[model samples]
Target: MSRVRVHNFAVSIDGFATGEGQSLDAPFGHAGTRLHEWFFGTRTFQQQVLGKPDGSTGADDAIARTWNDGIGAEIMGRNKFGPQRGPWEDHDWNGWWGPNPPFHTPAFILTHHPRPSVEMEGGTTFHFIDATPQEALRQAREAAGDLDVRIGGGPTTVRAFLAEDLVDHLHIVVVPIVLGRGERLWDGLEGLDQRFQVESVTTPSGVTHMTYTRP
Candidate 1:
């Protein structure tokens, strides 16, 4: 069976995946961009994010390399896909990833509203599913074939999956920073007793790399 994993997902010292007031200008919210400095400076990130190849190999490279774990398909929430709340007004916006998004594999987006699959540059196909997370996961797994189904999040989506105990492995990059108040990764998820034992931990640069497997 294929594993459902979250790779290189960054979180603040204060337990915020994204700061408050997320907008087009600030997707991670105010001061949230600083949390990803470790990734932004890495060679892997420079190539993917800035479309440039000017970064050194070191701790950053090692951590950034883990972001792409041969994922065959991606699943994310509508909010993470975009800020267009309620229902999608139209197909005018595909996502915040621009014309050439990172996830080249098929991506399944959980949404209440329906929309046709968005075919973008770099072989990224966004399929909007109106069903629950389990349904979306099933589709993503089928689309993934032999590779793993990656859960890309905006906190809530991950929480839903975590609550349901659907995820198998999780990788988190804890950055040394604190956003006093923002979208927390663990908010409203106190009752779920699904405990994940630590698989391994790597300290690359200032970021703490940790991996957990549901056992």
Candidate 2:
């Protein structure tokens, strides 16, 4: 079955998904980039960006491989896509990722502004959808075909999906660091009774790879 999944998402020791004061210079917010040290040192990420296999093949590699595999479509919130608030410009602004982005599948970006579909190399088409998370997921699932729908988020996006209980699986990489302030993954989650079971946990280079599945 086609399911919504958050794979290889990094969270700090203090439970912040990103650092505060996000800007063009700091997309991940302040020192939020440090949380992704595990991914940056993986062979999968190196190969995806540099076209070279010069990274480790241990726990980090296993987590990276799962996150990077068979993703038919990706859904990202406006904040995650770019800092652009209002209507997007022409096709000039592609994305943060360069020419050949890491994601090779059709990516659905959630935003209030609407734009035509953007076709990029390696089969990455950015589709701007002006709708709620549920609606976006429906469209993404259709676009994804047989592959799983991956939620590429910036905290708020994931929170919205989680609130709706639409996520089937969530794989978070808990990094050993602390961001004084930033976007948090579990904030304002009040009396809502939600439960998840740990599927697996592996330590690769001190980074803890945790997978949780809805029960």
Q: Which candidate tops lDDT? A: 2
The local lDDT score (0 to 100) that residue 37 gets in candidate 2 is 74
What's the residue-level lDDT of 56 in candidate 2? 79
Quote the lDDT for 8 in model 1. 76
TM-score winner: 2
User: What is the C-alpha lDDT profile of model 1 across 50-134, one tens digit per residue?
Assistant: 6898886786587567666778999998878987788676789888878999888998888889788989999899999887778
lDDT of 1 at 71: 86
- Candidate 1 lDDT (Cα, 0 to 1): 0.82
Residue pairs whose backbone atoms clash in candidate 2: none
State TM-scores per candidate. 0.91, 0.92
Looking at model 1, residue 122 earns an lDDT score of 94
Which residue runs does candidate 1 get wrong by more than 4 Å?
188-194, 199-204
lDDT by residue (9-89, candidate 2, tens digit) is 888889889888877888887874698777877788789867787987887887778885777899998888887778666
